[model samples]
Target: MRKALALAATLGTLAMTRALMRDRHVPLPTALPGRRETLSAPQVGTVAYYASPEGSGRPILLIHSINAAASAYETRPLYLHYRENRPVYALDLPGFGFSDRSRRRYTPRLMADAIHAVAAEIRARHGGETIDAIALSLSCSYLAKACLARPADYATIGLISPTGFDGRLSGEGPPDGHRGREILRDVLDRPLIGPLLFSGLASKVSIRFFLEKTFGATKIDEGLLDYAYATAHQPGAEHAPYCFIAGHLFPTDSTLLYDRLKLPVWMVHGQRGDFVDYRLAPRFAERPNWRIDSLPTGALPQFERLRAVTDCYDGFLASIRPSSPRG
Candidate 1:
C-alpha cells in the first residue's frame, strides 16, 4: 500500500512538471508576413493570406500541403517566384498554420469550402473573377474538389504530388482503413496529448532526419527547419498532422473529381517524392486535358530544384493564354 502511494506521488509530480514546462514557453499562435490581407470564411474561420497587387491578369492561388508543419510561407519557393509576374495568393488552410481550428471534423469538404471562400474573398477584393489554383500534396485534393464544384471560378488548375490516386486504383485499396482511422481519431481527438505528441515529433532533429531520409538529400537548411518548427508549434497547427495521418483530409474519390474537371489541368510529381504515388500519374495523364511533369527530385522537387521547376511552370503558363486575354 505504501509503495503504491509512493509511485502515484511520483507520477503526479512528473505530470505537474510537464504541465509547468509547457506553460513556461507558451507559443504565439499567429505568424504574419511582411504584408498580408486578412479574410474571413464562414465555417473554416479567418485566414491570414499574402497577395501581390502589382501583377496583371488572373491571380494564382498557392495551396500548401496539409501537415503539422504546413504554412503559406513554407511554400514561398512557388509563391515568391510567381508573385512578381502574376497576382498570387498563398493560404494557410484551416487547422493548419495561422487559420482557425474550431471544427471537430477536418473533412476534405470543409477544406474545399475554405479554399472556395478564400477565392470568393479574392474576387470580391479585385473585381468578380476567378483565379488559377496550384495545390501541393494533400491540399491538391481540396483544390481539385473546389475547382470541380465551381468550374468557372478557377481559370486553370495545377496539382503537385496529389493524393486520391490510391482510392482510384484497385491494388491501392481504401486510402484510410482501420489503422489509419484509429491514428487520426487518437491524434486529432485528443487535446493535450495531441499537442504534446506533435511538439515531440516535430523537433528539429526529427524534421531534419525526415527531410534527409525522404528527400534523399544530405543538405538540410536550418532556416527551413526553424520555419517548420515554428509553424508546427502554432496553436491548432499540431492537429494537422493528426488529420493527415487519420486521412480525414484525403479525398476518397479524387479521381472522379478529376474526370469532372473542365479546365486545363497540369500535374507534376517528383521521381523520388516520398509523399506521392508517382506511378499513378500515367493514368491521370491518359486524360486529354491533363498533362504531367515528372521531376528528378523528391516530393519537394520544387524546393530541391526551384529554378528548373519554376522554368517548367513558366513555360506551361506561357503556352496557355487567358480564356479572356488580360489587358
Candidate 2:
C-alpha cells in the first residue's frame, strides 16, 4: 500500500511539473510575408490572408495542408514562386495562422465553406475573373468541395500529395467511414487532457520532428519551423489541430469529389516520406481532365524542388486559356 501511494505521488509531481513547464501561449500573427487582408466568413468569423499584387490574368489561390501546425507558411515556397509570374494569394484557413483560431469543431464543411468565402472575395477583387486554385494534402478535398459548390469560380485545380488515393493502402482499421479518426479525436477533444496533449504535440521540438519527417530529410526548413512553432504556440491553436488529429478534417469522399471535378486537375506527389502511397492513381489513368506528376522527395516537395514544381505548374497553366472576364 505504501509503495503504491508513493508511486502515485511521484506521478502527480511529474504531471504538475510538466504543467508548470508548459509554454505560456499567445496567438501568432500572420507569418506569410506580403500584403495582407482580413475577411469575414459568415459562419467562420474573421479570416486572415495574404495577397500579391495583381498581374497578367486571373489570380491564383494556394491552400495549405491541414495538420497540427498548418498555416500559410506551408504554402510559402509555392506562393513566392508563383507570385513572381502572376498574382498569388495564400489563406490562413479558418483555424490557423493569423486567422481566428477560436475553439470550435473543425469540420471539412466548415473548411470548405471558408475556401468558398475566400474564393468569392478574390473573384470580386479580380473583377469576377475565374482564378486557378491549388491545395496541398487534405485541403485538396475542401478545395474540391468549394469548387464543386461553385464551379464557375475556378478555372483549374491543382493538388499536392493529397489524401484519399491511399485509402485502401492504409490497411484495415476503425469505423471512420473514410472521413477521419473520431475515436482519437474524441479523446483529444476532452477538456482536461486535450490541451495538455496538444501542447506536447505542438511544442517546438515536436513541430521540428514532424517538419523533418514531412521533408523526408533530417534537415528541414528552419524558417518554416520557426513560424510553425510560433503558430502552434498560439492560444486556442490546438483546437483545429486536435480536430485534425481525430481525422475530423479529412473528408472520406475525397475520391468521389476528385472524380466529379469537371475542371482541369493537376496533381503531384512524391515517392518519399509519410504520405506517399498514391498507388490508386491508376484509377485516374484515363481521365483527360486529370494529370498526375511524381516527385523525388516527400510531402512538401516544393520546398526541396521549387523550380521543378513551378515548371510543372506553369505547364498546367499554359494548357488552359484564361477565361474572358464576366460581363
Candidate 3:
C-alpha cells in the first residue's frame, strides 16, 4: 500500500507540472491576404473565412485539413494561385482559427453546417453562382456532407488526400452518425490532465514530428511550422483538437456521400507521406463524374509541388461546367 501510494503521488506530481506549463499566449497572425469574414451557422458558432477582394470568375472554396494546429495556411498555395484570376476563399474551421474556439462538442454535422453557411455567404457575394469547392484531409468529409445537403450550391468537388477511403469505403448512416470515442473524450476532458496532454501534442517538437511525417521528409515548411506553433498557443485552442483526438469530428460514413455525388469530382492525392492510401479510389474511377489524380509528393502536395498540382487542378476546373448536374 505504501508503494502504491508513492506511485500515485509521482503521477499526480507529473500531471500538475504539465498542467502548470501548458497555457501559452501568442498573437495569431492574419493567415490570408485579401479579406476575412464570419458567418453564424446552426450548431456551429461564428465561422470564419478569407476571400479575394476582387475577382471576376466562378468562385472556389478551399478548406484546410483538421489537425492539432490547422489553419488557412494549409491552403495558402491554392488560395494565392487562384486569387490571380478567379475568386478564391479559405476557411478556418469553427474551433481552429479566429472563429469561436469555445469548448463545445465539435462534430461532423456541425462542421458541415459551417461549410454550408460559408457557401451561402459566397453565393450572396457572387450573384448566386455555384462554387468550385475543394478540401484537404478530413475536411473532405465535411465538404461531402455539405454538398449532399445542398447539391446545387457546388459546381464541382475536389478532395485532397481525403480520409474514409484509405482501405475501404464508408458505411451508410445519418449525418449526425459519427465515430466519436466518448470514453476517450471523457478521459481527455478530465480536469488538469487534458490540457497538459493537448499541450504536449501541440508542442514544437510534436508539431514538427507530425509535419515531417506529413512531408515524408526532414525538410518541412518553416513558415507552416512557425504558424502552427503560434496558433496552437492561443487561448481556447485545445477544445476542437480534443474533440478530434476523441474521434468526435469525423463522420461515421463518408463513402455513401462520395458515391452519391454526381457533380464533377476531382480527387487528388500524393504518393509519398503517411496518407498515401487510395486503394478504394479506383471504385469511383468508372464513375462518369469522378476524376482521380496522384501527385509525386507528400500529403500536403501543394506545398511540395505547387506548379504540378495547380496544372492538374486547373485542367480539371477548365473541363467542368458550372451547371453540372448532381444526379
Highest TM-score: which candidate?
A: 3
lDDT of 2 at 302: 87
* Tens-digit per-residue lDDT, 1-327, candidate 3: 999999999899887855545556777888889988888876887888998948788899999999999999999988998899989999899888888899888998888888988999999989999998999989998998899889889988899889878764364666457778889888888766787798788889999999999998898999999899988988888889989998888787787778788889999888887888777888998877888899888999899899988888889878876465673
Q: Pairs clashing in candidate 1? A: 273-299
lDDT of 1 by residue, 151-257 (tens): 76777788877766653431233322212375556755665566566666677777787777556677755556667777765545556577666766666666666
- Greater lDDT among 2 and 3 belongs to 3
Which regions of candidate 1 fall more than 4 Å away from where they truly are?
2-34, 166-188, 191-193, 321-327
All candidates in order of lDDT, best leading: 3, 2, 1
Name the lDDT of candidate 1: 0.69
lDDT scores of the candidates, listed in order: 0.69, 0.81, 0.86
